[model samples]
Target: MSQLTTHILDTSAGIPAPGIAVTLFVLQEKEWLQLAAGITNSDGRVNNLWEEGSSLPHGLYKLHFDTQEYFERNFTASFFPFVEIAFYINSHAHYHVPLLLSPFAYSTYRGS
Candidate 1:
């Protein structure tokens, strides 16, 4: 079993992306269900999406980041209103999903 966590970096600004809304979802059958939600802290990290130290069951998961609001607040133009990264969890290691974001582009990967 493993728990989920995430962070966002504004690649264009070279800083942590603060205050962005992030949500975690699990795919069940054909529907996606929200499991946890949180806004990024000043450090752009959300480590406690669920209970700390508790493990999530193995399944397909998604991380949704609200980029539109972040860019709007910063008075910057953006191409993506939001971003979603979906991946599989089938191991016993902790999951760290990180987002590298810019106004017109973004990327994500399994992190440490």
Candidate 2:
């Protein structure tokens, strides 16, 4: 079955974006319903956002990153108030979404 996971890296600091808040949501008919939310660990990873053995339905999903709070705590300024990523899940494999972020820019891609 399909599984969901995520990781965050702070490019500006050249380290993992620890303690950052992340929220996962599934898009329904006309609204986005929250599925799970958690803060990143020291390694900046939420490897199991969903319950183990649970499978997600194939559709569009979103991940919200609380960049502002993370930056403020470290005495940094960020251009993007928040970061949101929308992606499609289409198989019974693990989806690893990794965020590489700086103060003014960020990038993400499907990871292994």
| Candidate 2 lDDT by residue in tens digits, 4-91 | 8889999988999999889999899979999999889999998778887988889999999988999999999889878999999887
- Pick out the ten consecutive residues of candidate 2 with the lowest summed lDDT: 1-10
lDDT against the true structure, per candidate, is: 0.91, 0.90
List candidate 1 stretches off by more than 4 Å: none
**Model 1 poorest 10 in a row by lDDT:** 1-10
| Per-residue alpha-carbon lDDT of candidate 1 for residues 1-112, written as tens digits (9 for 90 to 100) | 2377899999999999999999999999999999999999999998788777677789998999989999999999999999999999897678899999999988887788
Query: What TM-score would you give candidate 2 relative to the actual structure?
Result: 0.95
